[model samples]
Target: MLRELEKAEQKWGGANKAIDQWLNNRRNLLVHYCRIAGLPPYENGNSLPSVDNVRSFCEMLVDYVSEGHFEVYNQVVSACEKHGQTSKAVAQQLLPKINDTTDAALDFNDKYTEAADDKVLMQLDSDLSRLGDAMETRFQLEDQLLEVLHTRHS
Candidate 1:
């Protein structure tokens, strides 16, 4: 039983490590997206996108967001819950951050739908700012925990 517990703990540790890395990457992407978001919609090509074009691009972005922040994140959170780990609390706290990111993306979509002169950049900027803000908080929490653990274990 002791060995099993040790293994489980290690696995959870590994999972959280992965999540931290992924979240960092996601945050970076959001920053990058924001940098370009201020460009006008037509700023890309100065032409109106077809319905299909918009739908496909939006779908892809949503899928990407879900896969990273929801799908994989939820899997790790569930594992933590199953193991009765403190990760459960971490996961719960992080969930709202994910929602904030999602909301930003939705807001961008809403504005994109009605943007005049195809200036969709402002909406995209808003969305990225929201997502980046959430990511910053999540990463800070993770870093603080790591520092505490290091102090305790060292």
Candidate 2:
């Protein structure tokens, strides 16, 4: 995922301001996720992440998701409309999938954010795994949307 992010940054980093900033946030979000998920390099080898870490990750997660919907997705979709039918078709196809992932993300935020105590801690690992899958799906769909928009308009 980190490597994918680097490639995305290289591909679209200078393409648009909104996209660039969103990708940066994405990198931070991925790092926080890996830290919590205990996925190599960022792993603490611990069973569960600290409550503070979980709260921080949830905050970043929502910010990343919101920015994608409000800022980056809108820009890409607008560009798609300007290009042609094929681009529009790609965006339309991806939008629903992206929205599905958004629901998963918001659910994660809801579950973890209200965790004022460690009662949610028992299920944190499984929840993080599910959220990771959703995040990965979202990243792929978003990349596809950007690819269509940029390829057509470039």
Candidate 3:
């Protein structure tokens, strides 16, 4: 898992700098998420995540999603439009899938908005698992958008 994440962090760069920066934010968010979920290095013995870790992840998660939806998506669409009609058509076709993932991400964020104590974190195990699945889907969709709309056009 860690290896895959590291690979993704490095793979989606050099084409569009703005998209690279946005992908870096995604990488950082995943690192924080791995820590909170006690994956690999974070899983040694009783190295459960502290409340601070969870809180930080939640904060970063919101910021990342917001930027993706409001800034990065718009930039991608604009770039695709500038590229040509075919690029714009491809972006339009993929947008609804991307929007669905955004809605899922927002719902996940809402579940953790009031996460104030350890109990809440404990209860979040299932939600986090579901979030992992959602994030995987979102990442794949976003990568497709980057490839079709940004990298190819660039």
TM-score versus the correct structure, for each prediction: 0.47, 0.95, 0.85
Candidate 1, residues 51-144: lDDT per residue as tens digits? 4444444554565566666556655555656655565666576666656656656655565545554355434445556644654554454444
Error of 1 at 63 (Å): 2.6
Residue 25 error, candidate 3, Å: 0.6
Candidate 2 CA-lDDT value = 0.89
Give the per-residue lDDT digits (tens) of candidate 2, residues 1-154: 8898998999988988888899999999998898888888877765678899999999999999899889888888888888788888889999999999999889989988888877798898899888889999999999998888777797
Candidate 3 on 1-154: residue-level lDDT in tens?
Answer: 4455566556656656777788788888888887778786667455556777677787888888888888988999898898888888888888888777777667767767766777776666677888888778877777777778645664
In candidate 3, what residue range of length 10 has the lowest lDDT sum?
A: 1-10
Task: Quote model 3's TM-score.
Answer: 0.85
lDDT values of the candidates?
Answer: 0.49, 0.89, 0.76
Instruction: Give candidate 2's root-mean-square deviation (CA, Å).
Output: 1.1
Index of the highest-TM-score prediction? 2
Error of 3 at 38 (Å): 0.5
Q: Candidate 2: deviation at residue 27, Å?
A: 0.2
- Each prediction's total of clashing residue pairs, residues at least 3 apart in sequence or on different chains, is 2, 0, 0
* Span of 10 residues, lowest total lDDT, candidate 2: 40-49
Better structure of 2 and 3 per lDDT: 2
